[model samples]
Target: MSNYTVKIKNSAKSDLRKIKHSYLKKSFLEIVETLKNDPYKITQSFEKLEPKYLERYSRRINHQHRVVYTVDDRNKEVLILSAWSHYD
Candidate 1:
């Protein structure tokens, strides 16, 4: 299995700051660490977005939140685009 390097964007960082719940924040971090190791692992629940999102992908964090990202296989990197909530 290939290890992937995870890179979080500024928008995603801002999103993290907005997470008021400690448990949710911790869950997101744990997911990120898992992504860093093997982004394509089925346990991450990674899914490709709709055509409107083009090459973007998403991983569910919980019932209300998701982490949006894109995989760069050539570079072996996972570019985290944003942390999205259903409310916003």
Candidate 2:
């Protein structure tokens, strides 16, 4: 099996394809960098996370920053579905 995997959720992909209004450009970029540096750590840390939204999930990367995603437990892959500001 592959060591890691990264995927974009269908809804997020669809949203991104139509509108790039820049909700969390920098946050999203940071997530990309984090994933590149160490996908396993993020994935490991996120294994216990539960989705806050109706259809998507999210977890914190550094301090209170969030890394929203859905993971494949079988392959231990981390699929970042979205990113949200920790305001509410």
Highest-scoring model, lDDT: 1
Local lDDT at 22 for model 1: 52
The TM-scores, one per candidate, come to: 0.79, 0.45
lDDT of 2 by residue, 1-88 (tens): 3455667666556534332455555556666566644454545335434444443455454454466665566775667665543463
Question: Candidate 2 — number of clashing residue pairs?
Answer: 0
Candidate with top TM-score is 1
Model 1 steric clash pairs: none
lDDT of 1 by residue, 1-88 (tens): 5389889888777787776445687778878887888776776467878884478877888888898888888998999888868587
Model 2 error, position 8 (Å): 0.4
Q: What is model 2's C-alpha RMSD?
A: 5.9
lDDT of each: 0.79, 0.54
Candidate 1: list runs displaced more than 4 Å. none
